[model samples]
Target: MTITIDTTRCIGCGMCAYAAPQVFRVVGKYSTVISQPEGRRDPKVSNAENGCPVNAISVTR
Candidate 1:
């Protein structure tokens, strides 16, 4: 799986970090990926992508 965040579209709401602490964190004024999931899929990652209010996160397999 691959995860990417469009920084231009991100609002720095920290929802992604809130949804997946192990995979994401709030840095400065943006949410950034801390680590990728070892598995092909992660529910927390999906939740983070979906929870992003500005739709800045993208996940692909």
Candidate 2:
């Protein structure tokens, strides 16, 4: 899986981090990818992408 965050659209609400702490983090008013998972098998990653209020998170496999 590939994860990407559009910083311009990110609101820093931390929902991505809250949903997938291992993959995302809120930093300086934007959500960022902290680590890349091997694939989309991790459910939290999907939750993070879906939970982002601003649709800043993107996951592609």
Candidate 3:
């Protein structure tokens, strides 16, 4: 699976970054993709997606 952020929906909240610093982060006013976290699958990314207040993050296979 892959983790992607809908920049339009991102509010620079940085919740995902705070939840999983190694996998997600905010760059300026938008959510940015850091590196895919190790030893995990779609579920791991989905957790990050769920943490975004704006629902900006998406996990897809």
Candidate 4:
């Protein structure tokens, strides 16, 4: 599975960064993808998805 970030929907709130710092982080005022990349097994991906208030993030297999 992989987590995708909809840049258009992202408001740059930085909430995703705070909830799952290991998988998500903030860069230049916008949320960014960290070390864990697409198709990589991750433990906190679900937490990151839930943290997004606008539902800007999701995981797919």
Candidate 2 residue-wise lDDT, 1-61, digit = tens: 8899998899999988888899888889898899999944689998888888889888888
Model 4: lDDT of residue 19: 73
- Please give, for residues 41-60, the per-residue lDDT of candidate 3 as tens digits: 74546667877788888776
Candidate 3's TM-score: 0.79
- Output the number of the lDDT-best candidate: 1
Report every candidate's CA lDDT.
0.90, 0.87, 0.77, 0.76
Better of 2 and 3 by lDDT: 2
In model 2, how many backbone clashes occur? 0
lDDT of 4: 0.76
Compose the digit string of candidate 4's lDDT tens values, residues 1-61.
6677888788889887777787787777567787555665555677778778888887787
Badly placed stretches (over 4 Å) of model 1 are: none
Q: Candidate 3 has which clashing residue pairs, if any?
A: none
* Model 4 pairs whose backbones collide: none
In model 3, which range of ten residues has the least summed lDDT? 36-45
State the local distance difference test value for candidate 2.
Answer: 0.87
Clashes of each: 0, 0, 0, 0
